[model samples]
Target: MENNSPRQRQRRRRPKADVAPAPRRAAPVTGRLRPLSQEDMARISEASFDILHDIGLSDASPEAVRAVVGRGGQETEDGRLLFPRSLVEEALAGLRRDFTLCARDPSQDIEMTRSRVHTGSGGASPMVVDLETGAYLPAMLADLYDAARLVDTLDNVQFFSRSMIAGDMETLRDLDINTAYAALAGTSKHVMTSCSQAEHVRDIAGMCFLLAGSAEAFRARPFLSLNINHAVPPLRFDPEACNVLLAGAELGLPVMVNTFGQMGASSPVTIAGCLAQTNAETLAGMVLAWIVNPEVTAIYGARPMVTDLRSGGMAGGSGEQAILTAAATQMAQFYNLPNSTIAGATDSKIADAQAGYEKALSVTMAVQAGANLVTQAAGTQAGLMATSFEAYVIDNDMLGAILGAASPIPVDAQTLAVDVIAQTVRGEGHFLGHPDTYARMKSDFVYPAHADRQAPDAWLANGAPTINSAARQAAQETLANHFPSHIPAEIDRDIRSRFDIKLPRERMRQA
Candidate 1:
């Protein structure tokens, strides 16, 4: 029994000042870099609709063909689905704009209201950069779980997508089950992962249901969502990917319909042509989702990838890649849909000079363009083929600064501080010891935890740590501790009994 007496209640009550909301702090402000005008957007939209109504898509699933034909669409001689302009428009109009991405803990939920931009980690890399030797090694299941734990503690890296592939799992069944388990156990934040087969979706959903306590409770607030690469670009549905998308719809889970096309190869060489093709393919995917379940929540995925004309490989870190991705975010807003896209996936193998500029340029551009979820923002290198633990921590600091730069700063009467300035100049002769300066330190400034900001003498005296070393130290410290235990012991026992979970429970404990 608990005490509910008046004295006990009064003692628990916090003072008003402590409980009350703090003063409105100023956020760093910025605008879109060379954003498209309204007329430019209209032109792109018209071109996209024209492509869907004219060129059409090929080799859709039998379910998709039936659904399209039933919904006033036509099938080609070779079995392609020709979506009329009206069908695409209807799907666009029916999309749900506002929804909540629930986490294991209620407080970690992300509201997709599109109020401000949020950056996080995302990738499916096969290799991991060793924290001790800075060498690339095959990523294992343990690395994925450790990445989740590191992401959980990083303040700026808000959500954790499946950043690395568990190369140790020999079977897809074990991989899927343990991947979901590692993510759920490592972090309470929202976790997004993809599946190779439709049945895996149900299995993962069952796991989520168990975590939520029941099927009905899981449906009410499903914490897990699926990232479905619903279509192969140049207008064709990937058979397996489409099945996964439909499965996600059947479970009422949020689906991210990502359409990836390499410009100048799968799509046209011109930026406008690429956007039009991608937009049309994306709309076709939305139609498929609506046909499966009319009320499914879809995330508009815009992967505006570029190809290096010289070598014909992906130019993920190029300036053109950043520009195209930023502009594609504008297209997502045209249909009033929540959007996610790739950024900060550098082509560099190491977290050196090349990596810094490449990641920062793309990420900053995406934040300024107001993307809802910026994927590949952390722990990605070598054109998304590898992840670095040190770079993950460094990228968290970079994302914090990027977000701070994008934040809106309030410049009003109170912020002017004319009185404070005069008082400082007259009495102290400088603002260093001023009361206002001390009060505004936290409110006005955004500081990087891993970045060194000391003078030459102090820096030399402290052994002059580089960014890479500093991030490595932080990553080691975080992985040594910070094991979250939200899932109960009984639930863990039941999950282990039912599924083929490979991650050892004892390994989750700190040494």
Candidate 2:
């Protein structure tokens, strides 16, 4: 008997004329908010070259000094590494301009070329915002895994960076290894983490190689990347971080050359001056990556925080920070380099009104200005010192609105709906039941799950939950049941046996 139900018959007879375009992992933002004009970018680039040639970065590593000098850079008697303009230009031309960051699951790979505007969490905050108890406490390894799990389910958050440092780990070695393990266990999306020593980088790679089935397979499609802070403020190389950078480069891993120059403190107070110094610092890192292996994929990382001159403290939530992030994005474009910057951080301790405004301002600017990757874009508070689980859901809704604001609206024959308007005017005086309206209902709009949109009386009937409370409920539901099965059990056991993974297997299991 070949009997078909009504639902089955409807599904079989569905029209093929309504085929929608394939959605991208992250849509490329076309809006351009270049605070610095083309002339200004040129002037900034020239000034950066001057700083590199004249003021030169301080180098402590013998290998780095040799690599630079061998490549036409000069070393002063005081040990400052001087880069000639030609050398900087040559490195810029030779650097890997574009690449894809692969993930454990092949479907989650991210294209790192152009201004694609992928937002993710960052900052490696040391504290966690306990929404249940409403207390800020030292973040633990469990929190890190939970954060990754939450990110895996978020649509707007494209990738997961180790958002919080595992402060509960007794040693730095344990912290680094466990952080890597937790992030991997939590999601199959592209994961990025940092290592305290160069050896940790190799150890993490070995773990990843095992997960990928072989060394060659891992190298062919390396699923993990490193975010190494290759230099300290005021132009000095961090020796240990430099080693990590070189290790990742030699292994052909994607290395983000993060440079942090605080305005009015580590760098000049003016926005232009800060960009110039940070740009020079970024160039030095590129040269180092070139010295390691010219084929290494480079991500031009900028985290130039603004300082409050009145109190001599960080003002990460200020408008100046957002402006600096957008301006630096323009500089990365000027060099034709892939870029990432910090946004969405707030000085507010909780995810309240203050946090809302602070995150909205910076995140919007970064998206509109066309940053390739914007870190600290979710689950951050207290000036990048803490992460809140509830904030993840709330920020996801906010990021949806921001993406909507940045995404272009199509104005085609079907979209314009002139015929639909005429039909409505001639007949029912409404087009809600029209075929065109029905076809566009779900695809043409972003419906937020945590944000409230009910009528006043209906809202009161449902207990009138605040955004934070609604977000908390949503986050609780996700954490309670969303356990991903990307990594096989046998592979997980092998990894645990091979490395000192601190996160318990039971913790990853859903209720």
Prediction RMSDs, each to the true structure: 8.3, 8.2
Local lDDT at 162 for model 1: 89
**Model 2 clashes, total count:** 0
Against the true structure, whose TM-score is highest? Answer: 2
User: Looking at candidate 1, what is the lDDT of residue 450?
Assistant: 79
> Model 2 TM-score?
0.93
Give candidate 1's error at residue 146 in angstroms: 1.0
| Candidate 2 residue runs with Cα over 4 Å from true position | 1-26
Off by over 4 Å in 1: 1-31
lDDT of 2 at 504: 70
- All candidates' lDDT scores? 0.82, 0.84
In terms of TM-score, how similar is model 1 to the real structure?
A: 0.92
Candidate 2, 1-511: lDDT as tens digits: 0113232233224332222323433455543787989999999999999999998888647777887899898999998999999889988999887678888877778777777778888878989887567689788888888899889888788789889988878888898888989899899888989898888888888888888898789878877888888888888888788788888888777888999999999999999999999999988988888877988888999778899999888898899999998999899989888888889989999999999999999999999988888888999999889999999989988988888778777899988888889989999998888888788766666777678999999999999989998787667666666678888999989988888887777667743
Q: Provide TM-scores for the models.
A: 0.92, 0.93
Q: Best candidate per lDDT, number?
A: 2
